[model samples]
Target: MLIASSRPLAAAFDLALVDLDGVAYRGPEPIDHAASSLMAARASGMQLLFVTNNASREPESVATQLSTLGIPAEPDEVMTAAQAAAAVLTRRLAPGARVLVVGGAGLLTAVRAAGFEVVGSAEDKPEAVVQGFAPELGWRELAEAAYAVQRGAWHVVSNLDLTLPNERGLAPGNGSLVAVVRAATGVTPVSAGKPEPTMFTLGAQRAGAHRPLVIGDRLDTDLAGARAAGYPGLHVFTGVSSARDAVLATPDERPSFLGADLRALLVAHRAPERSGDGWWVCGAAAARVVDGRLDLRPEGDRTTTLDLVRAACGAAWEAVDTGSALDPGSIPDLAVHEA
Candidate 1:
């Protein structure tokens, strides 16, 4: 089981490596309580680093968008997967080496900043290929990456996220795009984003934080990545994941802390307790399996909806890990409307 902290995360950790999209905002709209809680966290002496898997834009552009969303940010405070990919590539290639750029200007700029010459095609005899995502990414760019990788240029992909949220809906992410090149070239590129520790390490390094908390909305990328990086991460119910997902999360993907929003950072975490045949949380909700069916019920003292969420997750994770059946119908209404 993940341990709880005595103090709130904002005060317990020196820095927070926050993921964008679902955590801070959805498309162009800012998430509820994200701005004010973050502002409070900063005032309480916690450093903030906006870590994004979207490499389509540069750091300055990302920071600008955050400011527009009411979250204060600066270029140096943002970390991009593109930068992580370039750092890995730079360590292997010689300075001024020719690197074929396959995605957006961000990837090119990062590679160039790392002292490499950015090229556009295999005809340039590039030494390596760096790829990311951009709306304008075309078949021509992917073809260039395939040709370069097939010709033996070392390949690197900034991220492997299969989907990214846009104004319309879910769209193919850089991971999905990278698959095309991989299929054509019969080669795989080294990934530098979530589920890999490189980006988190770089963010912590930049913030000079020895104990940094990873804050995100997705379990697969953010929470899973934090576990892979050997750091504790907090789960905010403002994005793709819900309390139900948390209850069914694999052992490795479980988050250390659960919060309704960024505001939870200001309050200390209270862990659930193991009761007779189940788990109880916040003295309001309890969960247990009876007759091969999961049973979640409220006690006399009712608390906030998050208490039930916490109880359900604690019992569900325990049951799953213990080889118990968790039928869908067995779970009651565990949704919390306030995020």
Candidate 2:
């Protein structure tokens, strides 16, 4: 299911819309080889835009964090869901519209920067409500958003990610917080983040990119966003999604390229080929699915485990696409642990 690229990805794509937390860093710590790999891609003339669904932090703050992680970046090179949500509000509401701010400084700053007056409570008769994620958020913010939404105010949210990866583990994301308001108000807010394509489209437009690649760890957000934006997606196994997930990805969530990590950008990607005996082969790795069970083998020569993953995914995807049942248990364990 993967696409072939004779040239290295850094050379093939003019700009890379890269995900932040899971792809580059796990939290306060950096992922292995992420700094070096990204630096190499930049050296190869591929511009990088750090795109994040976490809308709590501003671009300058994010850039500072990346710099501390050894990935030098400019504020302009970062795109946040806050910005996309602001853009969404700007297009729908008139200038100087009163908006109830339900998140932190980032969401407040974006809404204000978009020329909307920020209000704290629904009593202000806010014209709309925009929400994002903030560690300090509590029932008060959710209640305010709910009241505004119930009063027929337009509702916009930065993202709908239920979970967020952090230094400790998975925590509630903006979507989980948004759920509280949705339940109370009976209104589903318009999402302006990943899996919707606005963030990726804005990144490519800002970069002036003719050929942009979306690279990230989560398939649902990053890869799905790419599909929605009509861009190629490269899935890396360094984060939440695993090899098994890739092998079982649905049509809307499948990625165009697979890699162990960001290092995949520096190398050529080989597309899996269908062999005569119905096995899918990539380099020396061959994979086949028989009776809903997956079978993997190393053929003539030694091959990287990632190639085997590609081949396996190809075989499994083809089988699933052709109306054949696939057992999730048949998917191999090819986990790449984060350091």
| Least accurate 10 contiguous residues by lDDT in model 2 | 330-339
TM-score to true structure, per model: 0.94, 0.97
lDDT tens digits by residue: candidate 1, 169-201: 788999999999999999988988887888999
Clashing pairs in 2: none
RMSD of each predicted structure:
2.0, 1.8
- Which regions of candidate 1 fall more than 4 Å away from where they truly are? 299-304
lDDT tens readout by residue for model 2, 196-239: 99999999999999999999899999999999999999999888
Which numbered prediction scores highest in lDDT against the true structure?
2
- Those runs of model 2 whose alpha carbons end farther than 4 Å from true positions after fitting are 299-304, 336-339
Model 2 alpha-carbon miss at residue 267, Å: 0.5
Question: lDDT of each prediction vs. the true structure?
Answer: 0.85, 0.91
Q: What lDDT is reached at residue 259 by model 2?
A: 84
For model 1, the run of ten residues with the poorest summed lDDT: 299-308
